[model samples]
Target: MLPTTRGDFWAEITQIGMDRLWMQRFHVSLPQVSTVASRPGRRSIGFLTECNSSPLQHCGLNVLSGDIIVNKFDLAHHRSGADYHLGTMSLPTDELDTAVEVIIGRELLKSPDQRIVHPHPALMSRLLKLHKAVGQLARDTPDILERPEVARALENELVHVMVRCLAEGASADTTTGVRRHDAIMARFEEFLEANPDRPLYLTEICAAIGAAERTLRASCEEHLGMGPIRYLTLRRMHLVRRTLLHSDPSKVTVTQVVTDHGFWELGRFSVAYRMLFGESPSCTLRRPAEQPNIHLSRPSSLTTAEPRAT
Candidate 1:
């Protein structure tokens, strides 16, 4: 994952593995691209674990509190505006597929379309409590889960609630406008990735991606909460940091790295870099590489991130 916001990134992650399912909790700082890729044989879902927190953007739509997003056959993108607390659960398709069909009177894997399911408030409350309880148990009293019967009961209950949510959820299908903008953003990202080392012009990007400037701008604003140029600069600032952190000072000069990433305005680049990273490029180059503090994460080259407007 790439760092989207300024300063050092921080996060904390916790996970518990069951016989066939896994539950995870993530407390992350900064809004960065978080993706769930289709496993082909497994299914996954994520939700806001905290009460009344800011909504996470799922394919350009806001995923409100208590709402769940289920991943389908393609890469799914989720972006947050700032710090977020989230929980997730996943199991093999075959494991829960049968249970879901039996209880819901429908097949879970029949459709490959990703979905946002808003479970009824009362039912979702129970699910969230159980999910939160499970996470709490795993953290403070993991030995309690060592009991086979206890573990089995929890897993069974978890599955039951999951199925109930799916059965009762008021599902929202992707709108035509959202889908079109999502596709445009995807194409725009592909183009940027294809030409990583060069300074990109907006006109050139629009032409190559076959999107009008206005559409591309709108897509970026919706998904990333920033305009294209702002995002590009934010993206490169972090890229430069990544390179500096890894490069050997004896072998590489800062200039080579900065220019290589397509920045030519050395005068302004230094100021922006310091403003975003809270350090001089040379200082970062000299410091030792450090691991991310706290939670779970990574950003993509084409990943979505929302930076505050200047």
Candidate 2:
């Protein structure tokens, strides 16, 4: 178990199942990253950034007081703990994965083939301001976790706000090449949300966003940290999972819900969803009367669903 400080706001571990995934939450009275070890794998959403710390990723969105960072980690190589208030969400690892996939798909327009390798320091600086806004919100807003819907809404707003901020920053850039790159990402995200239920091909996405494959891919790699297809798939799966959990199972079949959310391959969707959430789609459908106790790695304040066993 990772160490915790006395008086630090935290959540008890809610569930630990077959897959090596868990959930927890913490408040940001004092900044720390003690929960890093729990996610031994890379590509996990380890923490979201808040206003207290620097924006660690390549894009320069300001760190707002109530803004969340939503950190994903590849535990294989731990980046140094850059100065930032990393907030952990209480959703299961799989849920986070699914959410990230959905977010990238719905929010990012870049292509997988385009690859940008280097980090942009200037962009990183701008992101810091957004982080600060989020942090301020967190500090001012009391009992965010108690109101799950409100909390989720705030999280979503933060993401959209950051995307807009990124676009603004890109517009200010003197280099037409970089501005075009930013435009592709912006347009891509817009296109994705508008067509969440449609099949998204790489060529279609790039064409719609009016970006070359290489440039779009590089922007995605640099800003969003994912390729196009994988990100879209994940986003679809996440939406499916959320629908399963929140909707009336009696009114919706698993296949219907998944397909409606843009998941065409049933078998592949089932497998990926299981790997991320630690349970089958059917599990989410079955509305249990009692919530199960579970364990999560991060602090307790930033979670949505109740953790369960596989």
Candidate 3:
């Protein structure tokens, strides 16, 4: 397994082969734990077994001192300036959303906006029961986790319980409270998700979101760290990547996929795709057909310790 640590923060993590689940045990005695970078399509469910500090801030949201920590996949950091211990598992987007909808209700998953849930007393009580059960299983029946059926069953239980606890704890106001920038971003994301095949410019986005050009630009830069146009470009590029990854190269070409996604300028498109995904568009297109053992590497912009799965 890869070791990730700095100062008082350290963790040993393992990925379950090609599956999206990751198990990690991390310990820290500092005021704050460093933000660990991760890809965008997952969520982290952590158990805070030990903590003697104030509320924790994760991804700019507050995580109350509790038995569970649940947040969407993003750069994570502990706001506390004191010591704490954490046990965490990562689940992919679809798994998380489905579990949440089934356990709590579909209302929570309908909003694509990221949220931090402070588990209520009732939820925490239920989590404690799950934590004991899973902890014992991890320790004494390790082989059971290796079984796909067993692991999936446990994972489903964990995801459902976590979401149920979190949603119950959250107040209606808290769940519906969208900050100014977050609201703007949500509107933009909704627009893009609905119109993935539609081409749009900055002025068009501003009008759709009902924000002025300057306001939209500032909000995107502040929340997403990019202007609206750049953000749209990157989103479109990701859509292209997804299409290429899943398409049959025998019947489809990289150029055709890009054109279908409204990427008119092929030259610049190739460069941007490479920079974002660390591979050329053609490599991605060929990947499905070739079925190479090595997949395209992740972008270098993400920082993390060595990812070792035992």
Best TM-score among the predictions, by candidate number: 1
Off by over 4 Å in 3: 1-178, 289-310
Q: Who is ahead in lDDT, 2 or 3?
A: 3
TM-score per prediction, in order, is 0.83, 0.46, 0.47
Candidate 3 global lDDT: 0.58
Scored against the true structure, residue 231 in model 3 reaches a CA lDDT of: 62
Write the number of the candidate with greater TM-score, choosing between 1 and 3: 1
Assess candidate 1 and give its TM-score to the true structure: 0.83
Candidate 2's residue-wise lDDT over 232-262, tens digit each?
6655665676678777877879988888887
**What are the RMSDs of all candidates, in order?**
5.4, 16.0, 11.3
Whole-model lDDT per candidate: 0.75, 0.47, 0.58
Instruction: Report the C-alpha lDDT of model 3 over 1-310, residue by residue, as the tens digit.
Output: 1111223232322223214455554444434324355567876666665444444544345555564555543444343443454556677778777766777556563334435455677667666566556555554455666677877776666666667765665532233423565567667766876777667888888898887898777666554445778767766775787788789899989888998887888999898777666779888888743332232222111112311110
- Judging by lDDT against the true structure, name the best candidate: 1
